[model samples]
Target: MGKRDVDDDDDDDGGKRRKASGGFSDHAPPDDGQSAEIQLDQMLAGGAGLAGLGMGMPGMGMPGMGMPGMGMPTPGLSVPGASAAPELDPLKPATTPMDFSKLGANMPSQEFPVPRDMVEYLMTPEHRQILLEETGCDVDWAPDESKVQLKGSAEQIRKAQRLLQRVLMHCNWGRSEAKVRRLLKPKIIESAVLRLSPMNTLPAGQKTLSQTQPVISIGKDKKANDIVIPAAIVSRQHCVLELDIDRGAIYVIDCSTNGTFLNGLRLPPKTTGKVLVSHGDELLLQDPANDQEFGYVVNIQELNVREQTKLQAPRRLLSTEESATMGRDFQ
Candidate 1:
C-alpha cells in the first residue's frame, strides 16, 4: 500500500507541472521563439540580441555605420550632404562692362546739315504744301534744329531729297541778280503789283504782293516799310497793301499822318477798317491841300486764270491746279 501511495503523489505533481507549461505556451508570441520580456531583458543586458540594431555591422549605413567627424563613418559608403555641392566662392567675378570703344567716333552721320534759311523756308506752310505736292512727303525740322526730318517711304524720301536739292541749288542765289527766277515759278492764288510814279518826276515803281508777301508797307522809313519812297511828303508808315487769299481781294490801309486819298475819298488813319481796292483804283498818300498825279495804281493779276477775282464781293477761293509755265521773274 505504501508503494502505491508514493506513485500516485508523483503522478499528481507531474500533471501540475504540465498544466503550468501549457498556460505559459498559450500566452507566448508566435513571432519570437523566446518570450518578449526575456528578449527585452537580454537586450538590456547587452546579450547577442542587441545585434538587431546592426551596430558596427558591415554594408549597413547610418545605424550600423559610424557618424562622420564623430569617430564613426558608414562602412564602404559615403556620408550624405558632405562635399556634395560644388564650391560657391567663384574663381572669377561675373561682370560685363560696356565696350564703348566699339561705338566708333569716326562713323558718318545719317543726318545732313541743313542751312537755317532752308530750314525756315521748308518749315513754312506754303513751302510745305509745295513739298507735299511734289514729293508726297511730310517734312519737319528736327528738335535739334536745322535738320530735315522727312516722314515717308524710301521712294518718297528720295523724291523729297531731289526737290530739296533743287531748292537748295537756288536758295543760295536768292540775293544774287540771277535770271534763274523762272526755274520754279510756283502758281499764285492771287497776287498784285502796285504801280506808282514816285513823285510824277520818275517812271512807275512797282511791288509784287502774294500770299508769301501779303503785306507791303510803303513809306519813307527804310526800316519799317518794304517800299521806302524817301519822299518829303510821305510819313514813316504811309500805307499798307494787303492781299486777301481767302477773299481773292486786296485792301489798302492808310497809316500815314498825311491824308491818304483812295479814289478821292480820304481814309480814316489807324482805323480798324480797310478799303477794297481793284486793278484800276488809285492811292494818293498826300494831303488833299496839294494836288498830285504821283500816286499808286493797283494791278491785280489772277495767275490762276480760272478763278475770276471779284472786286465787289468777298469770294471763297480754292487752290488752283499747278500749271507748268516758264518765264523770267524776280523774287
Candidate 2:
C-alpha cells in the first residue's frame, strides 16, 4: 500500500511540471524591451537641460557660481531679456595707477623752460599726464608755449625735472619715444665751475675771486670780500653767487641796499628772491642808468664741458690809465 501511494504522488507532480513548461513554450514572457540605443537616447535627452545648466560634465561647478575665469555667467539666474556680455574693446589702453612710493616728498615747486625742440614732445597730453600722475607734480604749459611750470614739493619737483632732462636729452639723441620712457632715474651733476668777468673798468687794487671757487661774493665793502669793486652805487652787502654742484646750476641772490641786477634787470632782494644765471649772462651791480659802473658776465660750465678741460683760468686785463684811475675811489 505505501509503494502504491508514493508512485501516485510522483506521477501527479510530474504532470503539473509538464503543464507549466508547455504553457510558457506557447508564448514568450515580456522582456526588458528597451534597446541600448533607445536607453542612451533617453539618458541624453535628460542631460540636455543639465548641459545648459553646466551640470552634466565634470568640473562644471554649480550653475551661476560665477567663479573667476570659470567661463560661467555672472552670479545670478539668467533673465529672459538680459543683455549679452560686453565685448572687450581692443583699442583701449588698460589703466594701471602709478606707484608713488618711489617719488619722495617735500619737492620744491619750480618752473622749467622746455627746449624749443622738445616743446611739442613734452607738451603732449599723454606725457603731461604721466608727469602729474607718476611724480605727483602739477604741470602746466606756459601761455607763451616756451616753458612748463611744475608745482610740487622739492623732491617731486626734482624728480620731474630729472625726467624732463632725460627726455630732452633722449629726444636730441633721436631716441624712440619708448626708449625715452625707459631711461628715467635720478641724476647728479658731477662737477661745475662759475666764471665771472668785470663788465667795466675796476679800481686799481680791486680783485675778483678765482673762477674755480665754488662760491663768490660781490659787494662795495673793500675788506673781507671775494670780489671787491669800490663804488658808491653798490651796497656794502650787495649779492653773492653760489654753485649747485649736484644740479650743475648757478643761483644769484641779491642782498643790497641799492640792488643787484641780472642782465640789466633788477633782482629781488635777499635770499627770498633769486635767479638762475645761465651761460654768458650778466650780473649788473647797479641800476641800468649807471653807464660807467661795471658788472660781471656769469658763465656756468657743467661736467660735460669740464670733461673737455676747456675751462680758462681767472685773469684780469686792464689798461694803465684804467688801473691808475680805479684806486681813487678806495682812497
Q: For all the candidates, what are their Cα RMSDs to the real structure?
A: 23.1, 17.9
Write one digit per residue (lDDT tens) for candidate 1, span 61-134.
Answer: 33322333332443443333445434366777766787898553443223445677555454556655655666
Global Cα lDDT for candidate 1: 0.53
TM-score of 2: 0.39
At residue 214, what lDDT does model 1 achieve? Answer: 74
Task: Candidate 1: give the clashing pairs.
Answer: 66-72, 66-73
Q: lDDT (CA) for every model shown?
A: 0.53, 0.55
Report the C-alpha displacement of residue 53, candidate 1, in angstroms: 99
lDDT of 2 at 5: 15
Ten-residue region with minimum lDDT total, candidate 1: 322-331
